[model samples]
Structure formats: C-alpha cells, structure tokens
Target: MAHIVVLSGAGISAESGLPTFRDVGGLWKQYSVHDLASPGGWERNPQLVLEFYNTRRQQAREAQPNAAHTALAALESQHRVTIITQNIDDLHERAGSSNVVHLHGEIMKARSSVDESYLVEMNDQDIALGDLCPQGKQMRPHVVWFGEMVPMLESAADIVATADVLLVVGTSLQVYPAAGLVDCARPNCPITVIDPGEDVKVKGATIIRKTACAGVPEWIASLKL
Candidate 1:
C-alpha cells in the first residue's frame, strides 16, 4: 500500500471547534506565550501553568472530530496513513487514525518533571499542583513547552522522507521544525496542501485553498483510492 504521510496543525483541530493560537479570541489573546507556555513561566508560577493546561485539556476533551479528521482516518483502509501533528489533542486518534506522531506531545497525558519517560494518561482530569509522579516529583502536562526540544522531530522527518504522498493540512507552515518537515519529502513525491487561509508558497505543491473540512474530502474523492 502507498504511504500517505499527513502533516497537520491547529487549523484542522479548529474545524472541530478548537481554536488555533493565532485565531481571534484564541489563547494567545488571553495569555502571553512566555507566561504560560515556557519552562521559565512554570518555574515562576506552577499553579497558573497547571490551571491553563487543565482548561485546555478540558476544551480538548469536549471537542469532537470533524470531517477532515475522519477523512484522514479513512485513508488507512487504502494506504499506510501516518499522521504527524503539532496539535496536542487526540482528535486524530479519536477519529480512528491508527498511526499518529505528536511532535508537540499530548495534552491528555502528564509526565514527571524529572523523568520524561514516566508518563501517565490523564483523560479529562485536571493536573493540579499536588499531582505527584511515581518518583515523588510533581507531574506536569506532557506537552512540549515553547523552548523544549521536540523529541519526535527525527521520527517525523524520517516518515516524511518515505512518504509516497505528502499532505500538509491546516498549518500555515510558519512554525519551525514542524514547518520544515515538508522539505524532507522526497523530491519526486506528490505534495498537496489544503487550507482555507491565504495562498501558501510551497514549491511544486498542489495547494487547495479551502478549509480542511471542505478540501480533505474533496481531495480524497479525486484520488479514487
């Protein structure tokens, strides 16, 4: 089966009623990135950090997958579909996409502050200040903070390199590392980018200027796969 590697971002999740960082009334408008999304912020105010993520996690839990997510998941029936997402939500998994790589880590999980490998599923629970890990250290959201290294970067790049077809969805291609994954694709591989936003400048890419909900299903329909 052909390998279809999908690089998704906040745009797709927005279709499911989740807001993107830059969107109107987004979290960015309410909070400073440094004050809530960086290690330095956590150091200064752990309670504030915990509350912020707890609210976000609840929002994620309330959201349902949209057409775009379902369309991508359906692709697994005909191809080896792999999803690399910058989103911390599990809408892709909820929509039934089996292979997903979350470069930004998952919001529905928590890990020890001292032990990155010691993670636990958090479902819809809030991660309060006193939440402790097995080693007696406070647990923090499993998300990759702004300045932290993205552990899944190399894996995502390797997947991109092997893609028979590359689909870039919902992202503006402005974020680093994740933004660069598209460039890792084999030169000859077919590349498709679907977004409702303004024109994106990806050389040789077949850009579909429509929201993921509208564009993804249309693209799959054309594929006849």
Candidate 2:
C-alpha cells in the first residue's frame, strides 16, 4: 500500500465550527490570541492563558468532525494514512484516523511544568489555575506556544519524507516548522493542496480550490480510494 501523509491545519476544524486562530471577530476581536498563546504571555498572566485555552477546549469538545475529516479517515482502508496536524483539537482522531501526530500538542491534554513527560488527558475540558500534575507542579496547556520549539517537527518531517503521496489540507502553509514539513517530501512524491483560498504556492502540487468539507470528499471519490 502507498504511504499517504496528510498535513491538516485549523481550516479543517473551522469547517466543524471551531474558530480559526487568525480570523478576526468574536473573542479574537476582543483579545489577540497571540497574547494568550505564548510562554511570555503565560508567565505574565497564567490565568488568562488558562482561561483562553479552556474556552477553546470547550468549543472543540462541542464540535463534530466534518466531511473532510471523515473522508481522510476512510482513505486508510485503501492506503496507509498518517496525519500530521498543526491543530490542537482531536477532530482527526474522533473521525477515526488511527495514525495522527499533533505537531501543536493537544488541547485535551495538560503537562507538568517541571517534567515534560508528565502528561494527563483533559478530556477536552478545562485546566484550572491550581491544577497540578503528579509532580506537584502547576499544569500547563500541552500546546506548542509561539516562540516555543515544536518537538514533533522532526518526526513529522520523517513521515513526510517517506510518503508516496502527500495531502495538504486547510492550512495556508504559513506557520513555521510545521509549514516547512512539505519540503521534506521525496522529490517525485505527488502533492495535493485542498483549500478554498486562491493560488496556493506549493510548487508542482495539484490545487483543489474548495473548502475542506467539499473538496476532500470529492477528491477521495475521484480517486476511488
């Protein structure tokens, strides 16, 4: 079977009604997500950061996987599918994709400040101010905040490098490290980009300019995979 690696971004979750990180309006208009999503911001006001992610987690919990997510999961029956996502949400896993690597960490998990290995599942809910890990340290969102190194980048890159086919979904290919994973794919591997936006700049990629919900299922149907 061919190895298919998929790189998903916030756009996939956006179709399920989860807010995109960069979109203006709603809570974003009231406050910049960047302010609450960085280590420096966490230090200045951990409460604010915790509250922000708490709200995001609640939203993610209430959201359901959309057509794109399901189609990607179904592709596993015909191909070896591995998903590497920048999304903090678990929509991919909920959609039944067995293999997923979260480059941005998961909103449904919390980690100990003292020990990186100490992690606890949050069940897609809140991590309050006083929440502590077994190590007796304050718990922090497991996410890879801005300015923080993405620990999963190397692994994701390796997966991309070995892929027989690569699918770029929803993401604009803007963010670092994670965005750069596309560069790791083998020179001759076929690449496809699915997004509603115009003129995505992935050289030699076949672009499907449509929303993830509409484009992914259509693409899969065409492939008969």
Candidate 3:
C-alpha cells in the first residue's frame, strides 16, 4: 500500500466550527497572541492561561470532525495514512484515523509543571487553577506554547520523507518547523495542498485551491490510490 502523509492545520478544523487564533482578533476577544499563547503569559497569570485553554477545550469538545477529516480517515482503508497535525484537538482520532502525530501537543491532556515527563490524560472536564498532577505539582495544559520546542518535529520529518503521497490542508505554511515538513519530502514525491485562500505559496506543490470540505474528497478521488 502507498504511504500517505497528511499535514493539517487550523484551517481544516475551522470547517468544524472551531475558531482559529488569527480569526479571533477584535474587541470582543481582545487577547493578543503573546498574552495567551506564550510561556511568559502562563508565568504572568496561570489562572488566565488555564481559563483560555479551558474555553478552547470546551469548544473542541463540541466540534465534530468535518468531511476532510473523514476523507483522510477513510484513506487508511486503501493506504497507510499518517497524520501530522498542528492542531491540538482530537478530530482526526475521533474521525477514526488510526495514526496521528500531534506536533503541538493535545488540549485534552495535562502535564506536571515541574516534571514535563509526568503527562496525564485529562477527561472532558475543564482544567482549573488549582489542578495538580500526581506529583502534587501544578498541572498545565500539554500544548506546546510559543517559544517551546516541538519535540515531534523529527518524527514528522521522517514520516514526510517516506510519504508516497503528501497532502497539506488548511495551513498557510507560515509556522516554522511544522511548516518546513514539506521540504523533507523526496523530490519526486507528489504533493497536493488544499486551501481556498490565494496567498499560499509552496514551491513544487500542486495547489488544490479549494476549502478542505470541498477539495479533499475530490482530490482523494483523483489520487485513485
């Protein structure tokens, strides 16, 4: 079977009703990127940090995977599909995709603030200010915040390098490390990028200029894998 590697981002989840950070700008949700997404913000106010992620977790719980997620999951029946996602949500897993690597960590998980290795799965319940890990240390969201190292980048790159087919969806490819995974693909590998926006520029990738929901199924059909 062919190995299909999918690199997905927030844009794919947006079709499922989850809001992206870039779209949250304006007075109603006035938090700046640095204020809620960085370690400095967590240090400045852990409670606010907890609250921000709590809301996101709740939102994630309510959203369901869309057509793109389902189509990707379905590919596993015909090919070896591995998903590398910039998203923290479990949509891919929920949609029944067997293999998924989360580059940004997951929202439904927590780790010891003192011991990064003491990671734990969080139930659907929201994380509060006083939440403590098994080691009695303060628990923080497992997400890889700004300035934090993405430990899975190496693994993702390896997956990309071996892909028989590469599919990119809903990402602008502006973020580093994760964005650079496309470069790891073998020069002769076929790449298809799905996005409705016109600003994406990925060298050597064939653009499928359509939204995730509208484009993925059509593109998958064309693959005939």
Write down the RMSD of all candidates, one decimal each.
Answer: 1.6, 1.6, 1.4
lDDT of 3 by residue, 1-225 (tens): 999999999999999999886674444277766778898988988887788888888889999999999999998998999999999999999999999999999998888888888887877787777888887878999999999999999999999999999999999999997989999999999899999899888888899999999999999999966
Clashing pairs in 3: none
TM-score of 1: 0.96
- What is the C-alpha local distance difference test score of each model? 0.91, 0.89, 0.90
Model 3, 122: alpha-carbon shift in Å? Answer: 2.0
Worst 10 residues of 1 by lDDT: 20-29
lDDT of 2 by residue, 59-118 (tens): 889999999999999999999999999999999999999999999999999999778788
**How many angstroms is residue 136 displaced in model 3 relative to the true structure, after the best TM-score fit?**
2.3
Off by over 4 Å in 3: 25-28
Residue 36, candidate 2: alpha-carbon lDDT: 82
Q: Give me the displacement of residue 156 in model 1, in angstroms.
A: 0.4
Worst 10 residues of 3 by lDDT: 21-30
Model 1 clash tally, residue pairs: 0
User: How high is each candidate's TM-score?
Assistant: 0.96, 0.95, 0.96
TM-score between candidate 3 and the true structure: 0.96
